[model samples]
Target: MLQGKPLLGVTLVITATLLFAINDATNKYLLVSYDVPLVAAIRNIVHAILMIAILGPYQGHRLVQSTRPGLVIIRSVCLTVGTLFAGLALQLMPIAETTAIIYLSPIIVVLLARPILGESIGIVGWLAALGGFAGVVLIARPGGGLDPLGVIFALCNVGATVSYYLLTRILAKSERTLTLLFYSALIGAILFGLAMPWFWFGAMPSNFEIILFLSLGVTAGLGHFCFTAANRYAPASVLAPMTYSHLLWAGILGWLVFGQLPDSWGLAGMLVIAAAGVAVALRTRFARR
Candidate 1:
């Protein structure tokens, strides 16, 4: 059923990416004022509260009832890990470079989904996957991209994202969207709080900074909404590569908000990566029929 669903999924997925890119702007802003764990904690804490306000009284209760408790737990852990790695990489690498390297998650997801999701692969799938991988090389361009530690964390970001996608597919069969989100945030908040003791160094924030810290949760909560919604109509393997939309927007956001931009070589490389991802998505759509 190519029935416009994936097309809608693509559009909605890009919207979600833009939201995430904007959220990244807010998050990188907070990094200067806060430790990584605390930044993560504040986001989840505010998100849990915001969800309560928006959903208003246990409407998703039964939806939660429908979920497999085990998979939900896994989903939550992967999300926290992904966020942690992202924050760490953000601290270590340029925002644009980190975002580009993390685009490898789609490639990882395609590799993992076969056994994990019991999906079949064909020659075309392999070809597209290789094309996507090649695109990563172009974006990095050896003498360019990110530092070694930055590459490792970005690759770890790919690993965490793959795990998150696997968990999402596991839950796709039985859980409701609101329930998935509610439990994911609930679990993430708990784990983040627990991790605080290892890295807990901070002064209490000023009132103004406090507000941005709280947006930590708000933007993530909103981005996850768009993310989860996309998963319902399209598989992670389908939506995964499309997330490179982050790279282009990150450059713009990095410049407009942070007063930084990549050199022409980096921009040219990123354009190829983004175009490669889109081409594969379009090819997949055609191959589906």
Candidate 2:
């Protein structure tokens, strides 16, 4: 039922997943030594600079062109807010747990699309979303030693991400990919820059920290680029399951980097959430048939 260069798309998705996993782990490590807002601000600024430098000449003035400026700006805001929240959550929570919770964004987008995009969700979709939420609850259970504030931040990230995805759908038909990508980074940089003064710490980062800070932008840029490129090669349905590989990468990196592993409940929760997200994607795929 799925079409396009499945092999290439699958490979790109897997690559993107791995990069994103590494990005998350790196973010968590840096957040441990720096304030979350400062980390987010610097990351966004670097990302914005890299994107503009690489894409500006190719896109020329059309880089910023958008048929739907309002929606584009709103989408950018969502991305920025989501990044900040996720950074905060990573500071207080384990990488694997934070990642699993953030994975709930795709499921939330499925539900949110019903009202916001006038898309319909079948009974299976509803059940899958509930199952995903139940998984999140397990991971965030009381006395689990997880920070309550971190969990809240994770949920907030999910909310903003859902909005971002929804707006992406609305803008995809009218806006160029570079245009959308440009705005996402530009707005994030501007917003983060505005808040930098308050979050800036006087402590100087080590050279290694500086390298990781720079790689944050590199990974984020390349990850999204690969994911977007994959879509051009295959249907989203075919690539959707590949995204689950992120959990595996996250788990491995979390263990290697922080010596932290998700416990039984947390592991089970991650699995359930991953399964539910795949289910939701499959449901949408089959429905289109």
Candidate 3:
């Protein structure tokens, strides 16, 4: 059985969160001029190619092997759908706000862990989840001036994310991390590649933009690899709150890249979310003692 390494898992998750923030910022930048599906396709295509070129030579069939094929497929589907929604939302909303709303998935994951993963979340965990939700409400509250459609897309992403994380936790026991990452990359590449013709109408990207396109896969592939690997070391509940780090990364990227920053209320919301994550981490640490 995979051994528990909570500290390592938390560190891996935090690393993944930073990588995912960079990926999301890059996607938001490209979505301005490229179709969502087209951008998503390139991201996945490069991801699959990188995986095959890097891991295939060493692992070959082992990279695709899985004990529970059905669950892996379902998880891949959730990730693919979530990517679409996240892309659409990014096109219409600021990265930080879109990410803040989507971070609600971690809270939902905490709530679902007991029933879905047979993992218990004590009272502190439950309260942390509620605090996280309240933070999202602050970020998505009325008069926030966010696009309603973008908010909707982000919320949809939350559903997909919750399912994706839960499934990741479940599959971590029997599936190798590379196998899970490969399946997700393969499914996205195939689905979006098949649909590319309909969405491929943009001008040829400049050399710099081309590099940006390729970087999507690099960042995302690494992010997912870390994310999937972390689950093998920690339960879903412990790792869920660590994902809040994405909010901080997203906010910084949005301001630095796009010159967009959340207002006071939104900043308050982010602080609440961060505080809740800290609380959860401390609670988990103390409980272990």
Candidate 4:
């Protein structure tokens, strides 16, 4: 709650969002350059390493300490499902589109917060939720004729993301942040590993591919760490919508790396989502102050 920490949290969240967007954009590039199943597998393997080797030094005890074991377990599993599902969505869909759909996570979080977290949101949160949902609809709508499979994956990611944050909210009180990160990574590795056999066609990544895949894990892990801290230091109302900054970052990365940019529709939808989220963030700040 110190001035520096909250400011750090906000900056961390923004930077994390940028890294996360870059992660997706890079993953998309690698997905094109390499095999999906293999890229997915390597990403997990490297990520699992980061969880154990990298995070252990900072906060190792978080993994074993527990106040809500069942909640932690459920949250881990849900995130595993969500992460793998989102990866599959990426394999089927364009990166930019999938990223937009994933923005729906905050809307789901607001909706679920009432029942799960017993948080009372005012009209502003609801309006933001509605606007965010509309953005998803705009992207997924049939007239756009986005690939049906892509839409399915994107929507699945929405659920996966919601489950992730919901569990994060549940764990926020009890679990050490490291423990939460480890669980998500551990579950994602195992769950996705199991599915690997079904989809695995081993096209071993080139040296460059290996680095790219590892960066995926690093970006995600660090990004999530910052993301968690953001919620910890500030209210969700302050931080939740800021997560949507990923879109702006993603659009830039997509163009710079892949020469892909969201069209007019994508820009319009993102603007609506941004406006709605910013409004919610502003309202929350005002109410809290």
Candidate 5:
């Protein structure tokens, strides 16, 4: 049996969050110079290549095998949509606001679980979900420095990610983690590749831009790997709260990279959403206890 290692798990979760934040920042930076689809396609292609190079030696063809192939493909498509939407949102919005909006995925999952997974949410869960939605409105409201289109994209990302998480929960019982990971990368790469030629521009990117695009794949793959590894050491209850650290990283990146800061309302909104998410995570954790 795997040993419980909360400390290691927490460390890994925080590391993964930081890496993901960096990936978002770099992706946003790249979007200033490349079309959304082109950037997304390159990132997914690099991710798929890395997945094969890293997992192929040991897992070989097993990486592609899935007991629930249909669910796996749906999950992959959901992830692809989430990634693309997030990239497009980041292209148009501040990282802090975008990250805060995407954070609503957990709340969305709670609301969705009832109908989809037949899971029950108590009064507190309902309140927490409401609080998260309120926070989203506060952040997206007028004078919040967020573009309307970006808000739409972020909301779409939340929807896609909620679906992705739900599928992950159902598929985890029958699928290998590596297999799921491989399918996500492979499906994203293939789908995005097919769409890239239409969005392709002949302009060559600088060496630095190329490196940033490459780093997106590295950060994405490694961040997910660390998160998966973290869960092996500690239950989701222990790692979920640590994910809030992503907001901190997002704030810092937003300020450092783009010199953009969320207004008072936006900051308050982010805090509320973070608070609600932590409350829900802790409630579920102790409830299981």
Candidate 6:
């Protein structure tokens, strides 16, 4: 029932990618001075509050209602763990490289879909998946200068993300988009918020730090909103390739905010991953037709 507006959808998705890149940069900056739990707690708390204030009146009981409550909770847990891993990775690695590694999730999904979802990926899909893994090896190659622990965290995030995406694929058939989004924010807020006292030992955030902390939720919430809204205007095929724009934005922000740029090898790895992901997306689209 959604209207087709490909151009608008592309714009919104690109905007979402930029906002998310900014959020990641902000997270990396804050993680330098704060623990992962505290940072994640504040981000989700603000995000939950914003969602309630904006969607509560309009959505009412529907915001919390889910026919697949258990699966929804599982999905939310995946997101929560992914957030923690991502924060830990950002704390130790450059944003551009971390983001590139995290993107391995899509490729991982392709590899798993045949066994898990019973969808055949064909020869091209297998090759693309292999190429994607090779790209990660390049990024994490010996003498690449990346923190090994950070690479591990990024890979952990990829696992969480692959599970999240698979669950989303199953649940999308039965759930409303807002319900899923709200639960993700709600669960993250509750889990991290409960763990805050132990991780709350840092110096009180400065006025500017508080602002940055608050902006985390704003940017994240807006990015999700834009991403969801974009789906209403464009098909998944159009949106899929556009998601790769995140790497470009991440690289730019990483340089501008953190003065960090990926080395040539890292850049090449990112391009390979992007190319493979695009190939997978386009192949899926054509296969569907």
Note the Cα lDDT for every prediction shown.
Answer: 0.73, 0.89, 0.88, 0.74, 0.91, 0.95
Model 3 regions lying over 4 Å from their true place: 1-14, 226-242, 281-289
Instruction: lDDT for model 4, please.
Output: 0.74
- lDDT per residue as tens, model 4, 34-89: 55555566666667787788767766676557788788778877766666666667
Which lDDT tens digits does candidate 3 get at residues 83-117?
99999999999999888788777667768888877
Which portions of model 1 show Cα errors greater than 4 Å?
1-12, 56-60, 139-142, 197-200, 228-243
Off by over 4 Å in 4: 1-6, 33-37, 57-61, 229-237
TM-score of 2: 0.96
Q: lDDT winner among the candidates?
A: 6
Highest TM-score scorer: 6
Clashes of 6: 0
What's the true lDDT of residue 61 in model 2? 86
The candidate with the higher lDDT, 1 or 3, is 3
Which ranking of candidates, highest lDDT first? 6, 5, 2, 3, 4, 1
Comparing 3 and 4 on TM-score, the stronger one: 3
TM-score of each: 0.84, 0.96, 0.89, 0.88, 0.97, 0.99
What range of 10 consecutive residues in model 4 has the weakest lDDT sum? 1-10
Which scores higher on lDDT, 1 or 6? Answer: 6
What clash pairs does model 3 have?
none
Q: For residues 1-289, could you state the per-residue lDDT of candidate 1 as single tens digits?
A: 2323776776767888887887777778888766678788778878887887788565746645654788787888898889888988887666776787676665556566678787665665566567656755665667764666766777788889888877776787788778878877877778887876776565767888877777778778888787767766776557866777788788888889888777776666566556656655565556667
Task: Write down the TM-score for model 4.
Answer: 0.88
> Against the true structure, candidate 6 has what lDDT?
0.95
Query: What tens digits encode model 5's per-residue C-alpha lDDT throughout 1-289?
Result: 2538889999999999999999889988888887877888888899889989888999987999888899999999999999889988998999999999999999878888888989878887899899999999999997766789999999999999999999998998999998998899889999989999998787888888888888888998999899889988898888898999999999999999899999999999999999999988987898898
Structure candidate 4, residue pairs in collision: none
Which candidate do you rate higher for TM-score, 4 or 6?
6
Give the candidates in order of TM-score, highest first. Answer: 6, 5, 2, 3, 4, 1
